[model samples]
Target chain A: MTYDWTLWIVFILIGLATTLPRASFIVLGQRATLPEGLQKALRYAPAAALAAIVAPDVVLVGGALEVFNPKLAAAFAAVLATQLSRNPWLPFIVGMGVLWALR
Target chain B: MSPNFREGAREGFRVFLPLSVGLVPWALVTGMTMGGVGFTPLQAMGMNVIVFAGTAQLGTLPLIAAGLPVWLIVVTAFVLNLRFIIFSAALARGFHGVPRAERWLAGHLLTDGVFATCLEKMLSHEDPRWRLGYYLAPSLWSWLLWQVFAFCGVMAAGSIPKGWSLEFMATIALIVLLVPMARLRPMLLAAVTGGTLAVLLRGMPLRLGVIVAIVGGIAAGFAAERWQGKGR
Candidate 1:
């Protein structure tokens, strides 16, 4: 299928939006210090972002909190799988296995 | 090209190889999903080249698939990419002595993983050119491998089974990523706070809840770390 032509505009905007943030402090931080408070808070950005993305999908299934959702089951199982295998692919395989079985 | 570029890139690529193994699936899944949705292979590759952001790209996909407004998708991706700002800030000090053009190149190539790798190099030794080389080196491999595998996934999407729950695997991929980083109390707190709030605020329109959770979690962890006098 052909892409909606408008999607091209959206991509340019997204590309710009994403790139500027990655560039801003690189250019600016050379001249002035980022605010002290923000500098400290930025350290938490990774943990916060990852958690914010994962937690909702894991805990909330079917638009409500259901413990039995395949997602949640697979999520916990994946955690265990990572600890055992220490291989990144292991978790995904186990998680998908659990997801398919539970679903 | 600086004389150090080759050495730096080589070191960066070599060290990043293991992590790339983990990252390969993400790009593959993203490419496949783009095909599963309405995107043509060309469009998917175009987006891959343009976006160069796994998280933001993945985050925007669901919204797009749900038929959300384009503006909302853009905003979501921007908010998701905001973490790169922090990374840029951290990278800035290391890159300050470099040429502006080089800095721009590094900024385009920067990802959290590469940032971390380059930061480790900066910490171990204090050479501005070397640091830049290290940063750009791994980044090249990362960009190349990601695009190649993702393109393959897009081309092969139809052959792949639908019931494999690849998205859940993606989620699990993300979880494995999160676990190791959440080592400290502050980090753990941030993750827990963000995650809890996201689940609680799942109903917020246009997935603003994700933003709320991220900002809220960072604020919480920052406050906690400040209280403990352990902020770094």
Candidate 2:
């Protein structure tokens, strides 16, 4: 909160910590070629990573798994709407509507 | 620009425009969070511009507010953003022959949405120029929306209703994004593995659960693919 030199220094360090990993392979280029198997593994990593983030968000309530919660229900509705409509906005709209209504 | 590049850029912008709707709220929330934590307007916006990563920004804010040491906070961000290493590796194929400066710029602009969009749709395209154009359009669009909304959030953080739960939109947005990509059998298997592991490992310190879930999911997907190949 304090506008001080240490805070600013932390800001720069945080920026570097965040950006460098993203640029790692891009800058490494030919120097560090990924093995073919690693490349193959990378293909599935994104979906898995996304699911990893989302699942905890939807299912966890107060650090406990609450299966019957509105968030889970809303998530289910969103998945169904996304599959049926195949429109990007509909799932979000429907899911939020469900959450608001249930709450 | 060549016709191919222009076309790719146009397509990229159009596809990203609708999805950009989902980004605005998340960015605003990030800004509001920085403001709520007592950051000055300039500092909040500076953090947004400098870090350009919502998750890390939000994750570190509590630590900053609690007066934690700078090194620990930076290390936490490094661990939180480790997934980007995998993403850049996956995306390297598209930028194989790109100039060094340009690659650095592209890497800076990358976000979760942009990375997911590119990996799903554009990475397989044969033309590097076209892929670059496609990548840049969404990157720039997202950056613009994020900065502007985040600025507004910092300014108007007090007025926004606390109970609106507007941040829930981010979860809904992610769901919509993931559902389409999980249509494939192996991908679905990977998602299931990842989601289950994440829930099971939620108590892990430093959010290492995400990284572990991702690895488990990828291995599951790889095994599934090999099994299907053998069957065929």
Q: Candidate 1: lDDT of A54?
A: 77
Q: Best candidate, DockQ-wise?
A: 1
Structure candidate 2, residue pairs in collision = none
RMSD of each: 3.5, 5.8
Q: Which lDDT tens digits does candidate 1 get at residues A65-99?
A: 88777788888888888777766567767787888
lDDT, model 1, position B41: 81
TM-score, prediction 2: 0.67
For each prediction, how big is the interface RMSD? 2.8, 4.6
**Clashes in each model (backbone N, CA, C under 3 Å)?**
1, 0
DockQ of candidate 1 compared with the true complex:
0.61
Scored by TM-score, the top model is 1
Off by over 4 Å in 2: A1-18, B1-47, B53-103, B111-142, B149-158, B203-210
Task: Supply the global lDDT for candidate 2.
Answer: 0.79
lDDT of each structure? 0.76, 0.79
- lDDT (tens digit, per residue) of candidate 2 on A14-65: 9999889889887787577667776676678667866876787788887799
